[model samples]
Target: MPGPGSRPASEGPIPHLVLANVAKRFPQAASPAVDGVSLELARGEFFALLGPSGCGKTTLLRMLAGFEMPDAGSIRIDGQDMGAVPPYARPVNMMFQSYALFPHMSVADNVGFGLRQAKRPKDEIAARVAAMLDLVKLGALARRKPGQLSGGEKQRVALARALINEPKLLLLDEPLTALDRKLREETRFELVRIQRRVGITFLMVTHDQEEAMSMASRIAVMEKGRIAQIGAPAEVYERPANRFVAGFLGAINLFEARVVAATNDLLTLDSVEIGARLTVTHDRVLPLGTEVALALRPEKLSLARMPDSRWNNSLAGTVRGVAYRGEASDVEIELTCGKIVRATMANIGGARDTLDIGQPIFAGWSGEAGVVLEQ
Candidate 1:
């Protein structure tokens, strides 16, 4: 798999938003805030710019909104160059993390604020505001002020306002950060539903992996001011492009190993981490004795009291801890090789649920359960 800063070829319909060689650098910074990043979004596609704090996701979004100009490269929205376009002139609307709703204004007034600023006809503004309120399911609360609404309600009002202008691209900057856990989870689906209903291309900037994975049709994983990989959520998660992408996206166990054997569609690695030979199904053959990293998701492992013959790889260990997470349990086992490996076991009724700390156990997986990274 390709490592960080590698840009894959864009594949899809004609792009509605095209960013080419976009870069930004702040004064006296050690490195560029955003570096030579290029991406494309098809019309009506929901895309996410995902990364940790200070990885340049927000900077890229700001550049897209025309609030921050790139030091180098070009941005095109609907085939129009945005180099000279100001924030208000760009065919985009940004919903800030703070929601930015007027405290004294009613929901209807807030939703209609954009049209009013544009000096739209009174009848048109009223009709559009009513339609938007209905679309967001907040029509009944139209007379309520911002303070009178719940976090989710205020978010809907903010969304309605952002879409009121009918921008070609909608930029959401941490849209659900203010909501509580349950409300944030509920709002994710709502945002996806609303985006699909309106058929507007949504480009959301968020640090929450679950939010991006569940809502965006595709995600661009950024690291150190550049794109590490861009693909569907499943692709990015299951087949990560590098060690950074694998470990950043979710909980995974990485093991250092060297190629012991290779075939047309498989690889055998002599792993020092587990003190066992690991087998993985891969497309290409690697040279014998070549160093590589083996990555496995915690959920891919199965634990038992005894080694299973069905698994192509197995490791004996002693259970160190088990954390119950309602639907499943996260198990940490100390292998005989002195490595701690994590396995996620579902809470289905079975002997596995009766596992106790410090008990002897065997963790096993099939040959296809792991990803071999060259880096």
Candidate 2:
């Protein structure tokens, strides 16, 4: 369990699903596929499990879907224990990365497959299928086969099929991974709209951090079969728990330092590369002469020809490389002490030959911008 200030496995407001110390391991494997993991999802909340390949996000999703059982601990859905529940009996449905639409069947038949299999009345099934198709904006194309539709259309059919079951929870496993960058970005809002419209709890598994940040109400970042952190997208990114979380989420510059002096909510650290004391805003108390790392975001730093004394932190460096990225230019600087730092400057206008290699510069940042990482 984490404190009130920290993100907990499950905090207050009624959990719709709970996993208490869940664990799983495959035979002949080096370690547990999913270690002792505990998490909770609130009713009608959209949660995302984000991590790289082989980090156990998929295995965890499988356990929730009743496709695989946990070796240890317990799983509960809406206050019911699911240890012995079969896949068909679970109130959940999955939309896979490939969409898995039936190529030969009409869109209406495909969407109604789950209802038909459940032995619902034909008239009732038809009604639900029509509504689902309309919800996904594919009502006019209901009579077409999968091959006649575009890639995004096919994905909507899969979503319609999954939603027709009226499951309490919906699982999406990289549902937009196959689409191009532009369409993937567009579909995130559509998914959010669908989830909000139906008011169903959605647990999605994805390796794309941007996708999760855009759509999920909160995110759980997993690494090596364990959760690294869980919080709102901005919280996890700006207030990272450790070095791993800070570096994994985006571009960051980590500088090793030793504490020199400390006072309430403020501390001074000494780093060889900085050639000066670094000031930081910290809520946690640390003893004198303690070692820690400062996590600095690239965009937080401002480069100038002279040191900006008002800013609390500054270092002299030479611009070593520059990369143009349309809206901003990534400038790589090699400090006097040989440490490399990266800074991103907004390109208000076309900056052709703006910063030449070997040009001397000073990088400055505010004290509150740098996060002191204990780990």
Candidate 3:
């Protein structure tokens, strides 16, 4: 149980769902699919499970959707234990990766299919279907078949169908995988709007880092059937739990260092590459001979021709490559210790004026910007 004032599994003021020590395993598999997973979802919150492929993100979601049962632990929704609750009986709906819209049926019929399954009155079903279509801005396309709609339209129809039932929880499985980059980015906002408007708990599974970071109120990063870390977007990005997460979430530079001196406020580390001293802000006490990894984000570093004395972490390097990304240029620097560090600088004018390729430069960052990870 969550303490008072703490966030629940679902998003809003109410705690609608809870997973306690949920674990699962499959035959012929070496380990569990979901191991000791527990999460509290406040009602109406949007949560995202993010990871690389085959990291048990999808399997955990399936267990929540009633498609798979956990081998150990329990699942509860709104204070009711969901033991053996069949998929149809659970107060949940899923929008699959394929959209799964009926190719032969019109949009209205597809959206109303769930209501029809419950055997609601024809008028009642029609009203709900109309409202759902209008909510998704697909009312004008009600008469069109799935084949007649564009990729985004078909996705909206699928969303409408899933929401029409008014389920307590909505599970989305890579819902935007089929769309182009531009469309995917646009639809993310729409999904957030729908979730807020309906006030339903949404649990989404995605491998896309940007997608998870953009829409999810909080994210749970899973690895090898276990949660590696869970926190708000900024918390996870700025302070990853381990080396894997530091590498997976975004562009990061990991430097191996040895602790030279330690104190309550700061710890000085000797870099293996540049042989210069590195200062870090740490809460956990570190021994003088400890080996640690320092994680630094690409954008946190500034490149210059001379060392910045004010910067706690500074290194000299040779420019490796410069790639223009329209809005910014990615500068890769090869340090004297044979490690490559990347930095993203805004293209104020253009990459043509930015740091030239093969130029020697110095990279510097503040102490607070680097996070020390044990692994």
lDDT string for model 1 (1-375, tens) is: 122223333334445789999999999999999999998777778888999999999999999998899999999987789999999888899898999999989999999999998999999999999999999999899999899999889999999999999999999999999999998888888999999899998999999888899988889999989999898888899889899999889999999999999999999999876678999998889999999999999999999998888999999989999888878889999998889999998989755457899999999999999999887
RMSD versus native structure for model 1? 3.3
Each candidate's clash count? 0, 0, 9
Regions of candidate 2 where Cα sits further than 4 Å from its true position: 1-14, 349-353
lDDT of 3 by residue, 102-179 (tens): 888999999999999999999999899988989999889999999999999989999999998889899999988899
TM for every model, in the order presented, reads 0.95, 0.94, 0.95
lDDT at 354, model 1: 73
Which run of 10 residues does model 1 get worst, by summed lDDT? 1-10
Give per-residue lDDT, candidate 3, residue 128: 90
Which is better, 2 or 3, measured by TM-score?
A: 3
The TM-score that candidate 1 achieves is: 0.95
Which runs in model 1 stand beyond 4 Å of their true positions?
Answer: 1-14, 350-352
